[model samples]
Target: MFLCGSYVPPQYLPWSPGSYLFLLETCLFLLFACTAAGSAGSMPSMNNQLNELRSLAAKAENRRTETGIPRVAMVQGKIPEHMLAAVYDPMINVILQGSKSMTVGDRTLRYDPATYFVMSIDLPAVGSVHPSVSGEPYLAVSLTLDPTVLSTLFADLPKPVGRVEHNLGFSVAPVTTDLMDAWVRMLRLMGDPDAIAALAPVYEREIIFRVLQGPHGWMLREIAAPDTAMARVNMAIQWIRRDFAEPIGVERLAERASMSVSAFHRHFKAVTNLSPLQYQKRVRLLQARTLMVANAKSVMAAAFEVGYESATQFSRDYARVFGLPPAQDAGRILGDTRAIRP
Candidate 1:
C-alpha cells in the first residue's frame, strides 16, 4: 500500500551526534532515492498514458463526436498547422507522442514527457504541438478549470510563508507520478462510455488534487485570494475578456474590481506584466484572429467584430503585435492555429 500519512519524525530518538548524523544521512539518501526513481519512472508512464489518450481522442475526432465540455481532441493524423489563441478557460493539455510549447509574452515553456503546464485564469497564450513521430502522431486532451473546488481547499491553509512579488497566469513544472497515474485512469475511461459519466468526475478531481499538492500549487492558491493584488488582476482580466469589444477605461475597470485605479494598474501589471491597454489590445488581436479562422470572417468584418472601428487601424495594430497585416497574418496563422495557444 502507498504511504498515505504525512512524514513525521519518530517520537523517540537517541540524542547522540553520531547517531543523529547517521540517521539523517540515511533518511536523506532514502528520500533522494525515492524522488529520483519516481521522477524517472513518471516520464515513460506519462508518455504511455498520453499515447493511449491520443488514440482515443483521435477516434472521437474522426467521428466528430464530442467527448464532453472542456475537452478538445485532435486526431492522430490531424495536426494544427497554426497555434491557437484559446479563450479564457481552465484546461490542462497532455502531449502524448510529440512535444508542445506555449509562449506567454517573453517567457516560453516546453513540455515533453517529463512536464506539463497549467493556467488558472483566462489569459492570452500562443501554443503549438511539434510534428509527431511518423507512426505515433501528436495526441492531446483538455478540460475546463473549476474554481469552487480550488476555493474549498484553500479555506484553512496558512498564509503563504513567503509571497512572490509576481505570479504569472501560466506555469510549467515536471508532472508527478501520482498525477500521471490519475491521468492514465482518466484516459482509459474514455473507451468505456458506460463508466465515463461516473468515473470521469472522480478522475478529474484526482488530477486537480494532484495539482493543488504539486509544485505549481502556490500559483493556484494565489488565484483565489480576493484581497490580494493578483486576485484583483484576475478580476480585471475577466472583465477585459468578457467585454473586450467595448471601450475599456482603466479607472472604471479598477472600480469594478473594487480597487483604485492606481492599485489596479499596479497589481494588474504585476501579475500580467502588461498595462491595461496592452492587455486589451492583446485580447483583441487574438479574438480577431479566432474570428477570422473559426467564423471565416473577412479582415474588415473580423476587425469590427472585435471592436475595431477602422480596418486600417486594425491592420496597423495587428501588424505591430503580430508583424503582419490582418489578411496575410490570418492566412498564415489559419494554416496552423495549434501553435497559437499553449
Candidate 2:
C-alpha cells in the first residue's frame, strides 16, 4: 500500500515560471469539465464479478502483491495504521471485502464492497480500514494511473463536454457490471502467468474503457489532455513533491500551473483541499514519520532531514497532525512497525 509507482510521460513537461499575463489569460480560457459517475446500483452480474475479484485478491498479503502483473496490486488485512497517512499516487482503488475511509484535507470519503475511487493526482491523505461483518479481512486492489496508456485511448473517445469544475481531481463511484467484468478479466490473468504479457494490456484497456464510460469519465479524459485544470494542478503538484524540502512561493507555483496567483491558489485548494505549502508540509510530516519509525531516527534528526527549520516547530506541527508529540509518537509506533511491514 505504501509502495506505489507513478509513471509520467516525457510529453508532459513541467510548467514554467513567470507568466503572469498568460496566467490571467489562461485563468481558464480552459478550466475544467465535470460529470457524475456510477449511479447504477450493483447488479447481479456485478456481484458475481466482484466475488471473483475478491477471490483473486484473497491471498494478497498485508502489503502489495507479487502477482507478476505490472502496475496492478492488491492488499488484504489490517494496514499498519501509520502507513495509511501518505502522499498517495494516482490510482483507482476498489475495496472488495471491507471498507476504507480516506481523508484528504477536511474531506473524508468512505467506500465499501464493490466501490472504487479514482484519484487523478497525487494527494496527501490519512486513511483507515475495516473488515467485513463476517470478519473477512480488509481486501482491495489498485491500478496505478499511467498517462501514456490513458492518452492512447483518447482517439476512440468523444471530446469532453460539460460544466467546468474547479479542482475536483478525485471522486468515488459505484462499480458497474461492465467495469467489474473487466476487472475479472484483468485479475483472472493472474492464474495464467504465461498469458499476462500478451493479454494484460488488452484487459487493462477494457477496464479503463469501462471507467471512461462512467460519469467521472471526465476525470480520465481531462487528465490526459494536459491543458485542463486537473492536469495543470497535477503539474504543480509534481513540482511541490519534487522540491518539497525547498521553500516555495505561491506566485511561482501559480506560474507553474499557468494561472494567476489567486486563481492558482483557488484551483489548487479546490483539487487538494489544502494550499501548496500545506501539501508540502504533509509530505514532509509523512516522510518524517517513516524516518523515525522505520529507520529509528531521533525526533530532531527526522525533523531536520525532512526540511523543518526548527525542531520545536516540527514537534508542534507533528502533534497537531498525528495527535502526539514527536518523541512519544515515534516510540509508540516503533514497536508496531513489524505488525504491518510484512
Candidate 3:
C-alpha cells in the first residue's frame, strides 16, 4: 500500500503516456503515504526517549550529584510563583517533562517538552518552573557547552553560506528525533562507568553536532568565533559579570571589546537585549540576592557588598526587580520551600 524511494512495477508501465502518468501519480501517493507512516512510527520512539529522561531525572532529584554524566545536570521541581534570577551560562536545556518560562529583558520565552532552550552566551535571566498539580514535576537536563569543543566542531564542519547580523545569544528550538536520541545515549552513559570515559565525549560531540545543524546553530557557532561581533559582545558581558560590583564605564567597556562606544552599545543590546549599565545593574541585583539567600546576609549588608551606595536606593531597585524588598522576598522563598517539603 505504501512505498519509498524508487520503486516501479513493470506490469504498471508499458511505455504508454497514460501508463507513465498513472505511474508517476502512484509513486507520488506512495511516497506521501510512506513518509506519513514513518513519522507516525517515530513518535512512539520519541515518547519512549522522553520517558527515559523523565525517569532518570526523577531518580536523580534528591541525589547530591545531579547526574553521574560529566557536565550534565538533572533538574526537577514543582512550580514556584516567584521567579528566580541567575546568570545562565552557555548550556543546552532539554525539557522532558512539565514546562518553564524564562525572562530576558522584556522578552519572555516559554518552553516545554517539545522544545529545548540554548544559551550560547552567559545571560542574566529570571526563570520560573510551571509544573502541574497532577503529581508530574518539571524535569530537565542541562549540558554545559565547552567552547573548545565548539571551536573544534566549527572548524571541521562546513561554514554557513551567509551570516546574519542580528542574532540573539539565546534561543529555543523544537526537539528532533536525532537530537533526542543523542541525549538519550548521553544520559544512558551514566549507568555505564566503564563506557563513559571512552564514549561520553563521543556522545557529547554528537549532541553538539546535532545542535550545530539546528535553527540556532549560527548563534552557537558564533560563540567560538573570536572575530565575530557577537563574540565581542560576549567578552564585554563576561567582563561585566566578573566585575559587576565595580563601576563600569561604557567607553572603557567598548575599548576592552575593541569597538566604538556607539557600535558596542548597539551590538551589545542586539545580542543581549540590555544596555551595559542595565546589564550591570541586573548582575549586581542578582548577586545581592544570592548573598541574602545563601549567606543569610542582611539586606543592607548584601546591598553594600554588591557596591550599592545607598541602602534606600538598593531597596527600591531590589523591590522593583524581585517584586518585594530583599529580606521579605528571601524569607518568603525559604518559607515556601519549607512548606513544600514533606
Candidate 4:
C-alpha cells in the first residue's frame, strides 16, 4: 500500500520512485467507456476559445514539459507512436488542434478539438494522435491529477449524488466554455513566469471546479475520497505497478484493496478493462519494449529482465502489442534519431 500522500499512477504505468517520473512517451488514464460527443450547443463558438488555447499550447514539443506550472504539462507536434500503446498515468487531457484516440480493450475512444477527458486508472491503451484538417500538428495540454489537491476542493462544494456504478475511472465530454476559459487563463501564465506561483493554483482550481459540474464529475469525486471503490482499485493498481516484475495474484491484490476476491475483480476490470494477470502482462511488455529500444538490450535479455521466462512467448506477446517482432521494432525505433533520446 502507498503512503497517504503518495501519488498512485495508473496500472501498467511504470514509475521511477526516486525521480517521481512517469517513464512514458505520452500519458493518459483509461476511460471506461467512450460516449458520443456531447451536445454541440453546450458551448457557443468553442473554437474561439480553443484557438486561443491552441496558440498557447503550440509552444510545447512532443515531450512533456514542466513549464513552471505545478502538475501541468503540454505536448505538441509528433509523438512517438510506439510509446502510445503502453498504459498511462492519470490526467485531464484537452486537445487543442489535432485529434487523439485511445483503445482500451475492444473499444476505441477518439477526441477532437473542443473536447477533454478525465482519466484515473489502468490503461493497457493503444493510443494514437492525428493531425487536424488544416494540417496543424497534434497539440494538447494535460493536468496531472493530485488527489490531495482534489480532496481540498470538496469542503465547500455540495456532496455529489450519484450511483456507485456510474463512477468509472475516466470519461470524455465536450469542453465547456467555462472549462476552456479556465484553461486559457492557466496557459496564459506561461508567458508570465513571475505570476505562476500565485495564479496557477487559482486557475487549476477553476478547471477542476468546472469539470466537477459535468456529467462524469462523480469519477473525480470518487477517486479523491480515499475510501471509495475507485480509490481502492487505485490502491490495487499501485500495488501491481510497484511489483510488476515480481509475480502477483488477484487474491493477494484483492486483500490489499480490502475487498473480497469477486468484488475486487469486478471493480478492477470495470476501471481498467483488463484482468489482474492481463494488466501485469501489459506492464511487463511495455517495460521490455523500453529496455530493448532505449537501452539496446537484446530480446531474450529484455524478456527475462521483465520477468518473462520464455523468450518465444515474449516475442509473441511483443509482436501482438506493438504489431512487429521485438528485434524489428527496436531496430526501427533506433533508426529514428528522436526515438533514441532519453
Candidate 2 residue 59 C-alpha distance from true site, Å: 1.1
Candidate 4 structure quality by residue, lDDT tens digits, 1-342: 232234665773445774343322122221112121245544455777887887887779887766779999998877886677676888899988789998876667899888897786656677889999999898889998777678898666887565465445767898888899999999999999999999999999899888888876788877877788888988988888889989898899999899999999998888777788888998899888888776877888899999989989988998887788888787787784344222
Tens-digit per-residue lDDT, 246-290, candidate 3: 988999999999999999999998888888898998889998887
Best by TM-score: 3
Badly placed stretches (over 4 Å) of model 2 are 1-42, 336-342
Q: For residue 41, what is the lDDT in candidate 2?
A: 36
Using Cα atoms with residue i matched to residue i, what is each candidate's TM-score against the true structure? 0.75, 0.84, 0.89, 0.82
| Model 1 stretches astray by more than 4 angstroms | 1-66, 69-78, 81-83, 132-135, 153-166, 332-342
Which regions of candidate 4 deviate over 4 angstroms?
A: 1-45, 336-342
Ranking by TM-score: 3, 2, 4, 1
Q: Given candidate 2, what's the lDDT at residue 150?
A: 88
CA shift at 302, candidate 1, in angstroms? 2.3
lDDT digits (tens) for residues 47-154 of candidate 2: 778888888988899877767788899999999877888899888888899899999988999999988989888999999999999999999999988778888887
Evaluate all candidate structures by whole-model CA lDDT and list the values in order: 0.69, 0.82, 0.82, 0.80
By lDDT, the better pick of 3 and 4 is 3
- Candidate 1, 311: how far from true, in Å? 2.0
Clashing pairs in 3: none
RMSD of 4: 19.7
